[model samples]
Target: MQIPEYQLFVHPSDRNELRKNIWQDDPITAKLTIGKKKYAIDLAYRGSHIRDLRKKSYRVTFSKPSMFRGAKEVHWNAEFKDPSLLRNKLSFDFFEEIGCLSPKARFISLKMNGKNEGLYLELESVDEYFLGNRKLPNGAIFYAVDGDANFSLMSDLDNKVKESLLVGYEKKYGSEQDEVHLQELIFMINTLPQEQFETEIVKYINVEQYLRWLAGVVFTQNFDGFVHNYALYRNGETGLFEMIPWDYDATWGRDVDGEIMEEDYLRIQGFNTLTARILAIKTFRTHYKNLLEDILTNKFTVDYLKPKIQELHDLIRPYMQQDPYVKENLNVFDHEPAFICTYIEARGNYIRSQLDVLE
Candidate 1:
């Protein structure tokens, strides 16, 4: 699951041909493929010859013009410390069904160097609103590469930013100077009352469904849902925001210390922080309870997850038996649901306290 020692990108003109070859019955080595037959899919920034083609998608992402190449390249050193690539893919697929995630994205298999190159979850192109904030083009297409939690937070934050601009709000103090403003944006969105952004989000672009999606994620014990592993979008006409999840390497059963404690779950849910992302107990309960029950009691109940979970169990079993990292983290599977359920119960209790505070 770690990045390779080197990474490089296929020329833009060569990408289409590379895609075709990858989709074909057989694919040759990465070198034999040309711009037309097989373009490279590198994760390096401009001018870096080493194409890491790491075990994950960041290899394609860091090469983009948006972020600094140095910082991106530095992360490669830590790539190999990650879990098996197959594990990450299965985890993502499981949540895709568990959360009933968007059907627009899909996990596709590719071949390289005459061997299975693993799976890539390709998402449809999305327009970038942040670039517009810097006066970039309006409808430019950008490929998403990030994690699910981060993606969800981006959708919510972008909505708030668009709304603020629409309402004629002036630039806030020090907004531009903040180096980690993107991280702060998550805090802003999480603190909003359920009624504030929740309804607007639903009306703008199926926010209700997204809330249900988030609830499902909580149930799955995903604690690494940060802002990096996601993509952001705004409606071309309505300008409402939307999100898609990405970079699911640290999810499923990979918790530190191999325990999915209630504290850990709340921390992931944006609690125990001196920030605004914390939700009132009632707000959290009203949204997640009904959503969890709806999905659990309905035909889309936990039963739908059985096959996928079993698939994951089977797929990773061999690796788990061999991988020392996975072996050390094995207890994570046993504690995941208990952590989720306990966290959900705590949120229920907090909802009443939040109501009391309101009174």
Candidate 2:
């Protein structure tokens, strides 16, 4: 695949000032060029690594709700620490293939003021536009911005203020700031009796889709995504909330910081309270096991992913080899694909073995 080119033009003074500022919300005026089209956009530094890197991830928002390739906004990720540079794209591919709602992504060549800023991954922003494109019900969208939003009712109680339950969640949509609906969901998850939990839960959340999303996270070992790095949307039609995976650059045998993680670093439980509660139930446990088995047999196996991984590697290799900002060890660039392939094989086998003895 030929990587698309994106050219950004910003004031030299503003660019220097932004380098000194750590805030991600401070936007500067910029003009972006993609193909033959040009757009006036507000560019801002984004992500926790904003202060740690020269080439930073950015959030680009147009002056209007104009659609660029069917997206109103785009998140340009530097992928500085990832050697493979395919984690986010590959994870999203898996989610989409498994029938989960996820953002679209592509690798692109980025240039700032005619200087090659290196290869960046352009991801579709999960906003009203994304909801409309996926044809999913548009409702309240909340981002799990911090660790406190771990689906634990205890975290909610620790903050007596009614609005505190949403402390770690950033509401991306919906007008009312009130936490009534979110509070009710947490209350039910914590206090509901085991027998009634399953039936009652579905009234407020999509349990099947949630389980599938959880399987994706566990299979890919996205530790950060379990408790955080996700979006929760209350379906307008069914009034039930659903989970959307996000920030997967750290997945597939690596931690968020891009350090290698043990293949079995995540325990089936203790990652999120909701998942633990659901797995504790015999019926839900069986359902989850079945889902995992089907995923491993059909979707998550090495035989299925090897060629896909190779395809991505081949597509991104030329650009990645030329990117000077990549921080991974030189040797890692050559060996990382093999490592990912090995992870798929090991993780699938381990999960299957664990499922057999889970009782």
Candidate 3:
């Protein structure tokens, strides 16, 4: 299959500026050409460890932050560390199937100054545009950028009282009032009495959505997802927060460095203070237990995912053969479908065994 091509034309000075600003998120002016159309844009190198890779990732924003096919910005991830190159997209698709808000993604080919950058997964940015497209009411979005976003009163790293309730979240949309609302929710999660917390927590959060997201994380076993790889959105209409998944490349039987991770590495309860509180309530725990069982019986099984895995793997095989970073490890990439299938079978059985713990 032929993937869409994006041509980036960065002036020499802008290219130098972008290269020098490796860790900075500052974007430099550029021109992007896509299918006979040209758009002025601000482009920046994205990701932490990925910035050091030969095949790098990028964040592209329209110059005016205007919509381009329902997206104001796009994340072009090299997905270099993932041998399958399908984990991120697969995880996103899985979340959507299990009834959670997730970013949409597709494969693309990129060229910078006429240099081939090979295959990339183009991910949609979760912002105002994202909500508008879904016809959902406008909401505030905060990205959980670090371990401090574990919804706890104490710091995960230092184990000390947090200086503020909103330590690790980056406010991407909405005003200071929205930030205050988030702080209030986090405070309630940590402070309220058990019965009051169980009854009132639903007022501050969309509990069903949270449980669905929790189940997705539990199934995929995205180690970073519980704390730092999600978006907290405060719904304008409901006056409650909802969950969205992000940055899921390090999942599906692999660790961050692409090493093998056992299927049962993560637990069904998942980690984080908010999840613990939600599960502490008998009703919520029963709902979550049912959600996990339903998903395990239907969605997370090897039979259900094997064809999907093969389809994605086969679709990317041609591109994988030409990817600049995988000349020697092509075999590893080719075998990833079977590897993922094995993982699904093992992971499903593991979760099935652990479901009663939710009782």
Give all candidates' CA lDDT scores: 0.37, 0.81, 0.90
TM-score of 3: 0.97
lDDT of 3: 0.90
Ranking by TM-score: 3, 2, 1
Give residue 169's error in model 2 in angstroms: 0.5
| Winner by lDDT | 3
313 Cα displacement, candidate 3 (Å)? 1.3
TM-scores for all predictions: 0.45, 0.94, 0.97
Candidate 1 lDDT trough over 10 residues, lowest sum = 165-174
Each model's backbone clash number: 23, 0, 0
lDDT of 2 at 140: 83
Tens digits of lDDT, candidate 3, 1-359 = 56888898999988888788688898999998889878899888888788988787999898753668788899999998898999999999999999999999999978889987788999999898889989999989999989999999999989999999989999999999999999999999999999698789989999999999999998899988989889988999999999999999999999999999999999888999999888989999999999988998889888898888888888878877876777567899888999998888898889988887988
Q: Pick the candidate with the highest TM-score.
A: 3
Residue 24, candidate 1: C-alpha displacement in angstroms: 31
lDDT of 2 at 287: 85
Pitting candidate 1 against candidate 2, the one with the higher lDDT is 2
The sequence of per-residue lDDT tens digits that candidate 2 reaches over residues 284-351 is 77888888888889999888999999888888777776776863454687788899999888888778
